[model samples]
Target chain A: MTDWDGRRWHDMGGQAAGPVPMESHDFALWEKRVDALMVLCGQKGLFTVDGLRRALEDMGEEAFETYSYYERWIAAVNQNLIEAGVYATEELAARMAEIAARGPTYGEAQDG
Target chain B: MPHDHPDHDHDHHDHDHDHDHGPFHHEGMSPSGHPYRHDNDSPLTYWQRMEIAVRELLIDKGRITAAEIANQIEAMDARSPTNGAAVVARAWTDPAFKARLLHDASAASREMGFDIGPLNLIAVENTADTHNLIVCTLCSCYPRNLLGLPPDWYKTRAYRTRAVREPRAVLREFGLDLPANTTVRVHDSTADMRYLVLPARPAGTDTLTERELAALVTRDSMIGTGLPLRP
Candidate 1:
């Protein structure tokens, strides 16, 4: 309690949020890919797990609140890649635009 | 408005501030001489799409392979609470093992064959007078190497915020009502370290096999947010 900043999102606990649910959850395809990509890149020395955590922490409050848990991981991965010069931000935008034009053909009907 | 969309989109206007072009001049963050578009016919964000683009680029660059990424994903998917379950069951059955686990969770887990990755994992024990809980307030810093990914709510703003402010209340909401004198200690997982709770063995289970006992240990119990099932 000497010099701790309790205002941040990660340090928050024990405040109050009603009864927690015990529901079972399954990961989506993109989420699973994000987790694996983060680990693979980490093993490749692209960045550390701590680096991703710090990147997630540095996000603006708006983005921080908006993205889900796995979505945040993807964002962190993207940030690291862009920072590492793996691709230019312009390059990413163009790729995204191209994909969007091609339409949402994401999941390959694995389960859904 | 983008707000009306479920994805909480902000559109190309947000990036408009950084570039000099007003209507359609371009050269902001993307540097393509054109303003960014929200014509994303899908539910993906700029970041999510970036995830795909970057991953594909990495694969194409020979830095990583699609098969490698797929294998990693498969390995992660194969992990569940069962790894934690077996560890807790062994600790419950053997005093020496329990001590070993409490002394060094990562090594003990490795002894059982589940690679604990590079992070430090400390196993907190729950006794008659004290209980333990783990949370990553800044992000969902969980014991992924041992427990796979965490639950959605565990990373929610509500749980993250409240779990620190009122641990007992949050636990009670999860139906864990500790005694007034019981000391509830919450472990906030940071970047370099993670935690798993070695919940006390339930009563009347001495006759169960290690496998059966292991089956009783749910993901939430190891996280200290739920108690093991009584078998």
Candidate 2:
């Protein structure tokens, strides 16, 4: 698949070849893709909210807190995207509310 | 009393050397022109601090073992370089591969035996007539599975600020000056997905093996500020 610029994508070992343009709407598509991946992985119990909390504790309070700030910043960006009509407003609001209800607990409201 | 004064003077001189600065002339200066103070601002919020404390309490209560945590770090380190190299090699050898990567990066990466997650979100963008740069505007939400720990600058506020507003200028600062015809695309990696640039391979690498090509692709190149290694 070529990107918008019309470059071709080859598989590993340089053996396969095809043309596909990258979507102009990649950011929106990626968000949807990740949301799906999160559900799939969450169902498999690979990345649990509680597990992340424990991991943060192991990394120490300073690092964990910095990570939390990072999460908040991303959430704000998602909110902006929703405002810009880049994301679904209803979904964004629901997610934001869910995060808020988690009450700033370990790995509760924080996941990018 | 007079003898004590001399002794005190010597003691003060010793203290000055011990602090690694001569007798202080300015509150913020240490003989060097640079400020001698470190900013101690806590980057975390109050709630985050409380959460960390609570989590630690849980761990102490036997919820998780410290060894299990160490294992994660070991796993991450092992995964980082290989994933990075694979992406670089694929980009170098296959144009179609590069296209796929730019289209659906995570899936493409997985096909190469690499996982692009807890942040499975991936976006691939390309620039030829112009250059594109990537920065995690919020924090360093990098493709760590592919790239190792992001360089210090990637995580710095200076880079985040300049990368968006003045991308071309920032690239120049990194010693990457594109042709005037090149348009600069600056991507702010936010919540939905993160991005990695598919840098064009450098010349004179036609005969190199895939492994050798991978070695030439540095993390900075994927970030779009540096070129692949030469020779």
- Best-performing candidate as measured by TM-score: 1
B34 Cα displacement, candidate 2 (Å)? 25
Off by over 4 Å in 1: A1-24, A108-112, B1-47
- Per-candidate TM-scores read 0.81, 0.52
| Best-performing candidate as measured by lDDT | 1
What are the chain A TM-scores of the candidates, in order?
A: 0.79, 0.25
Candidate 2 on A1-112: residue-level lDDT in tens? 7444432211011122222111111011112222222233244444543333233334443442344232332333333333434336565444445545654432233322
The residue-by-residue lDDT of candidate 1 on A1-112, one tens digit each, is 5765646654445555554544323444555668878899999998887778778778756766566666677888888888988778888787677655644534211111
Interface alpha-carbon RMSD, every candidate: 11.4, 20.8
Question: Which lDDT tens digits does candidate 2 get at residues B74-180?
Answer: 44434544466678688668888877876788878887877666565454444457566888654455666677545546655456556776677677777788888
Off by over 4 Å in 2: A1-112, B1-56, B121-127
Model 1 Cα lDDT, one tens digit per residue, B1-231: 101224323353543222111122222332112333332223545555656677777877788887787778667756778888999999999889999999999999999999888879999999988899998876678988888777667867667777878888888888888889999988988868899999989999989999999989988899998899998
Identify the CAPRI category of the predicted complex in candidate 1: acceptable
lDDT of 1 at B179: 87
Per-residue lDDT of B43 in model 1: 54
